[model samples]
Target: MVKKVTALKPKDESISAYVRDLIEKEHRARANREAAVVYQEFLDKNPEECAAMEVWESAPLSDEIEPRKP
Candidate 1:
């Protein structure tokens, strides 16, 4: 049987908090979809750079430890 999933707010959580969480989740999903389209275009234009792009993506991110100096 297929299961139906539902989002349950905590007993002590307020309505506004629940709504905010839902909105943030929706925004994150939308951003990921947009990013996928951009990445696809990049690949289409630079198929030869796939290896370098993969290496860069696999590298650990350092943005959190040190902000870019610009």
Candidate 2:
């Protein structure tokens, strides 16, 4: 694994830097997966709310841009 990572990393990059980047990416993927599970559980528990949300999700966007309130 070390040999493969060293070979795949950029010529100017250090092994530690490359490994840290890989770890950070894996961590983010794991967190996103966990969040997705929680969101799905919420959707399952709230069928009526989910149905209401689907309506908003499928609604057409207005072409007129509203001015921001000061």
Candidate 3:
């Protein structure tokens, strides 16, 4: 899916533009993670829910989907 860039220019720019950049990136990453989890949940779930994870992983590589493991 193509995501069009939405500019968020807060008047006065309370924080610097650099900080805004960080916030935007982190937000996107967090949202992606939440989405991935919807796919990862396996046990204790209904049949269809468990299958969702498989569907996503089966797709071709496009971008980083997994969270950084320490």
Compare the candidates by lDDT and give the number of the best one: 2
Better of 1 and 2 by TM-score: 2
For model 2, how does the per-residue alpha-carbon lDDT over 1-70 read when each residue is reduced to its tens digit? Answer: 8899989999899999999998999999999999999999999999998999899899879767789999
- What RMSD, rounded to one decimal, does every model reach? 7.1, 2.1, 14.8
Off by over 4 Å in 1: 1-7, 54-70
Q: Measured by TM-score, how close is model 3 to the native structure? A: 0.39
Ten consecutive residues with minimal summed lDDT in candidate 1? Answer: 1-10
State each model's CA lDDT, in order. Answer: 0.78, 0.94, 0.66
Deviation in Å, model 2, residue 28 alpha carbon: 0.8
Give the alpha carbon lDDT tens digit for every residue of 1-70 in model 3. Answer: 1122224454554445646787899999999999878755643366775577569779889867999889
Per-residue alpha-carbon lDDT of candidate 1 for residues 1-70, written as tens digits (9 for 90 to 100): 1121123666677666876898999999999999999998988899777778889889888665777889
lDDT of model 3 at residue 54?
A: 68
In candidate 3, stretches whose alpha carbon ends up further than 4 angstroms from where it belongs are 1-15, 42-70
Better candidate number, 1 or 3, judged by lDDT: 1
Candidate 1: global Cα-lDDT?
0.78
RMSD of 2: 2.1
